[model samples]
Target: MSYFWTGEGGVPGDFAYGKIHLFAVAALIVVTVLMCIVGKRLSAKNKRNVILVAAVISLGFEIFWRGVWIGRGVPVLETWPLYPCNLAGVLVPLIVFTNNKTLKEIFYVFAFIGGIITFVYPDGIFVNSVLNFSILKSILQHTAIIFIPVFEYFTGQFKPQFKKLWLAIIGLFIHLFNSEYLPRYFGMEGDYIFLRSGLPFVIPGVPQVLILGPIAIIVMFVFYAALDRKGSKAALRRKKQ
Candidate 1:
């Protein structure tokens, strides 16, 4: 009796009850709300609000896209439980928790750029599960990514110059290594949509992944650097005040 749920009249491998996925979703909603509250309570001058706003935007984008894809007949949540959406929920909140403007800005830029890039180049894109699994997986995956850099940033180990770029790259690679980026590898036997559903990523190809990965890293650096410059100017203004 595997825990996977099979929805009624849905695709064969889709889960109907989705108990585990539901629990994860509930937890995320609770935590995200709590983070919002905490961020609001912090002094306005502290820029906690900035982090909160960024988190909301980041998380909101994932939710929006998930809905869009599902509406188009791709039950992404049901099929790919460990999707990129999970990363958003988890990592976005860290900015609020840490109240670090620099790190927050870095993540915001990366998310903005990454989202655009993925949307524009959704090569392996396909609908997986529509059961909130994508949300949970993204939340978890991103949480892992944010945790390391957040720890390093606050603990004085992270350098401002390349920290954000490094963190984003590391996060993406970790997703790849842990199979978060390749959810089709683990879903139930018949649920690997990319294999059968004309998905963009299942084909035998090293060109896109290899090419995109480096391009993403470079873009991350460029974005991080620009954000860093802006942050430096802001810091100087505060110091002058």
Candidate 2:
């Protein structure tokens, strides 16, 4: 029980990519699949409501996460919410409440891809126990992150277009700028969006972002293109019917 709230040192059984990790990933996959299937039937109002609910939940978990870190004696400056997943608190709500197509397109692809990538890699919270605060909050926050844009996509709230891939590029640039500036300005240490130390397997000397960032942008473009194609076909089919 003590380890559940412990945040100072490494806890016991802090294994990543192990049984609990895989189980969590599997459960996320199941939930995502179910949401996709069922979300199609939701009304626009319902979808927007879900987005708002997700935003609230994401905000709550985000606060809880920061409180945990603050309680651990980490400096308030170092605890700045600059991480990508942290956007879930604000962006998810704006996606529904505003008419900002740019925000919607930028975040839709980001949330979907980023959420899945983190689950596959378990982010940085690698506790073996599901009961641990780190693992529990990580799962909950990412779940809200995954749910918001996914619900938006399935319910026709956001139809991703290849042309708007530029929006995602812009978002990436913002992350890159912060990845460099935030750590320096606040004396905090982190790779941000894997731009600093690189991916899970950090290279000996290279900051892999220069290489991986463009590749990831290309990957996001491809995904957006494929989704656009599917959305087009479905729309055409409905028109014909």
Candidate 3:
């Protein structure tokens, strides 16, 4: 049987979407639900500690993964933590540790949306074997991404605000600009956030970056609005008690 630490794996020709993937997806969903339930049960201090520790572990794992890639001669441009998902590794820690409302909002909406999509359609990371470290890391990181925001919401740590959507939009634009323009200025071929070729799906005539950037913002807005409404209803119910 292959072990996660063996480091003896090859990139499969295509993502299988097979048993391992399904198991990981199912496990993530279960764990996220449990976190939401347990988060509500925890004392405020314990909940904060859980959030803080999870954020630190997520950020640390991301950095460690990048370091491993760099050690394996991966280019700085490709491994940079600038992609929306990678950025979440950094932003999540900041949100938890500093309690920065803007960062929290950006992470709660954008990260959750991105996390869900990436989890559902994990392309490269969905290996045929469960014991592969890359696949395992991918599953864990995306699980954390999906879990954190929801846990925060369930614990009343994050209250979605429509105005905070602007913060997320600005963050997206900054990443887009860096991914698109800074690479040219530096004479590097970088697709930092998949803005250049878009995600796996792209519209025919429109620039991939243009199409994805706006769509991402719009999707986040919709998610934020829905969650905000739900939270408001829950708040009202609580007040009635």
- Candidate 2 regions exceeding 4 Å error are 7-14, 88-90, 198-207, 230-241
lDDT of each: 0.47, 0.70, 0.74
In terms of lDDT, the best-performing candidate is: 3
Indicate the TM-score of model 2: 0.81
lDDT of 1 by residue, 103-149 (tens): 55445445444443333343332233443444333445444334334
Q: Give residue 17's lDDT in candidate 3 (0 to 100).
A: 72
Off by over 4 Å in 1: 1-46, 49-81, 98-108, 118-160, 178-185, 188-207, 229-241
lDDT by residue (tens digit), candidate 2, 128-234: 54457767777777777777777777778777776667888887776666656777787777667666543554566766765787687878867876888865566
How do the candidates rank by lDDT, highest first? 3, 2, 1
Could you list the CA RMSD of all candidates, in the order they appear?
A: 12.0, 5.0, 4.9
Q: After superposition, how far is residue 74 of candidate 1 from its true place, in Å?
A: 13
For model 3, where is the 10-residue window of minimal lDDT? Answer: 1-10
lDDT of 3 by residue, 1-241 (tens): 3545444665455565777787888888888888888889999998888888888888888888878777778887677565667767667766778888877765567777778888777756665454577777777777777788888889988887764667777767766665567667778775767755546668788778677767787787677667777664665588799
Write out the backbone clash pairs for model 2.
none
